[model samples]
Target: MNEQERMTRRRFLKACGLGLAGLSLSGYMTYLFGGTSVKDVLKSTLGGTGADGFRALENFRINSVEPTPNVQLADYRLTVDGLVANPVTWSFAELKHALTEVEQVSDFHCVEGWGIKNVRWTGVKMRELIQQVRPMQTATHVTFYSLGGVYTESLSLAEAMEEETLLAYGIYGKDLPAPQGYPLRAIIPRMFGYKGAKWVYRIEFTDHQHLGYWERYGYNVDGVTAR
Candidate 1:
């Protein structure tokens, strides 16, 4: 879809309040463009209640609007390349065993003004992956590409090295559900949700910052949450 069309769809989902309800996990392009009724979409996708009536991925019933990517854990490969001393590829098993696993309770803030609090996230710190590959001095930024192939997001090398920045694979003590970016995703707690690119499969260190999927259509490049 063209930039204008993508922006329009984004506005539509935001208006429907699905943007923060895990519709952001994958672009709801198929459902939105296929003339599915808003009522139907909401009915299928949004039926979960958490503490204080807030909804989170753990409790949210995920009804994928797009063809969910079939990712087998054994076959999935996460590649790290570009401007590094040693390019590396990791299988799901290797990643878990090789990296220092950590967990934290962080909040997910969407730009639409809704947030999920005290989210339990489990993953390896991005810095741990960076240390393994050893980025060159000229590599000032890193871009993460989703497995779905359309979505991408970038963060500065410094931001990626932060303790809270994680390449997360599980949430709430369970493997991420298919609709929630199954094998992997980035978790940038300080940034808004879009900055935490979902279904991510590739990481490339670059000399310049690459605009993310949302940022290309005028969302802030520095998507730090106001809170």
Candidate 2:
């Protein structure tokens, strides 16, 4: 899709999210296109229920609108290239044993004003993935590529090394839903959801931090939210 189409889709998505709950789309548009933020409006909507009015996403109702990639398990391979000292390629089977699989519960936040808390995710730590390959000292950032070959996101190496940043293959004890980036997805506890991209298949280390699909189209580059 073109840039104009993408923005329109995002606006429409937010409008649907708000309209479904009897919220005001115009107010939300102010938050998206204007300087007003969804968190501010949520305070009034939730009547100060929780910290920053971030509605604790307490359900496993499959609330995400992320797209899936068309990939067969046998053909799945993730590439770690670019500025890395030792670029490595791992098949899906290799990934299963790349690290000791660990499961953790984290809160999932979406930029369009919805969230899920205590979300159980299972997969390898991105840090471990990097450690196994050993990026060069010059590597300053990392770019995550999706299997769809369309979606992409970037993170500074420091941001990537933070705690609980995982490349997840399961959610709530089952394989990740295809629509929600099955095979593998990112689970970043603190940042807004968009930064935690789904269907990620490539890890390209670089000296520059490039914008992802959404960030390039006006979404917040730093998807940080109030704790």
Candidate 3:
């Protein structure tokens, strides 16, 4: 990474309280092998150099550093409320059986500088959900709630209504994995990962935008990644 990008990464990490910049765990490894630090090990796992053996990231993967929620689809409930004429709570089966599933291949990018490409996401369109609830004219943003309280995020009405925005229920041609938000989750291909709320269960349409968990920290509110 260049100096400017390095500065941005450090700033972001500091805001997230994981400032893994220069505070290498190299000191802890010194005692293990004749005082020679194991700096390369840390690099390999978190930010490996593009060498022949080290794998940086996996393709068609969905990931979150947060604690994954344990969910059983039989009991899952997705609530759609706020600024809507008809509020609805959809059961897992209702969504799965009622909506025609669509599969999309898109890249998932992280603000921390890594990306997973061509993720096969299968779900109903985000617009379809909005259509069911009939978002009021006053609704300007749609807030998503996930397993963790800090996992809340929002998208502008225009962004949330895009054809590519999805409430994904499956990935890689199978049921969504718990680590990747099983039952349901928002999958907006254009934004950074934080905007794709994991373990998402609730959608609330509102008049004003809410700062997502990361946005409240230091990440950009307009988290548009390069196409």
Candidate 4:
């Protein structure tokens, strides 16, 4: 393998916590000793290069706990308060039926690396929600909070109003997978995955830019990937 390809393989193996010794002797010997191409090994091991591989790894958690079954729809509530003139709370069923359903076919990119598989999302539009809430003139951004404190995201008013964006409740043709974000998840096509908060429970309108949980660390709030 060339130097660059070898370096990439090393990075992938390191990320996967696999050592050279861990590889099967036949594959290792053929590639390492016999000089068989490592390109196949890289492809098989890393899936794909760059952001796609990074994103797949970020979402990979083999032992992730499944979300509890949502048995009581009446008890499940989504609060839309803070800075809005018409603050309101809606139950799961209310949200499911009250809002107009819009389907979106968009790429889901992530700053950490990786993207969606041209997902089709069905749910209420962010513009419709903004209309319902009537964000004041001073409002600049919206912050989302998820159920388990595991995810959070924010978006500027303009970005949130994009037609492609939606608070998705279904993926492909079925209800959202729990690990993927159950009752509801935000889908912002232009921004990275961190902006698409999952299992959203509350949304708050604000007049100033506020850093999300991931953004507070080092992740970009806008999530614009390097092309």
Best by TM-score: 1
Candidate 4 lDDT over 85-195, as tens digits, reads 998899988886667888877766656454445566778898999898888888899989888765567888888888887999887656777776778888888887777
Candidates' TM-scores? 0.73, 0.70, 0.71, 0.68
lDDT of 1 at 85: 100
- Decreasing TM-score order of the candidates: 1, 3, 2, 4
Q: In candidate 2, how many Å is residue 47 off?
A: 23
- Each candidate: RMSD to true structure? 13.5, 13.9, 12.3, 10.7
* Runs in model 2 lying further than 4 Å from the true structure: 1-67, 225-227
Write model 2 residue lDDT over 78-139, tens digit each, in one string.
88899887787888888887777889888777676656656778888888888888888899
Count of backbone clashes, every candidate in sequence: 0, 2, 0, 2
lDDT winner, 1 or 2: 1
The lDDT leader among the candidates is 1
Q: Which residue pairs collide in model 1, if any? A: none
Expressed as tens digits, the lDDT of each residue in 14-109 for candidate 3 is: 876654533445444432221112453454435545632112122224446578878877788888999999998888888777667899988777
The per-residue C-alpha lDDT of model 4 at residue 210 equals 74
Model 3 clash pairs?
Answer: none
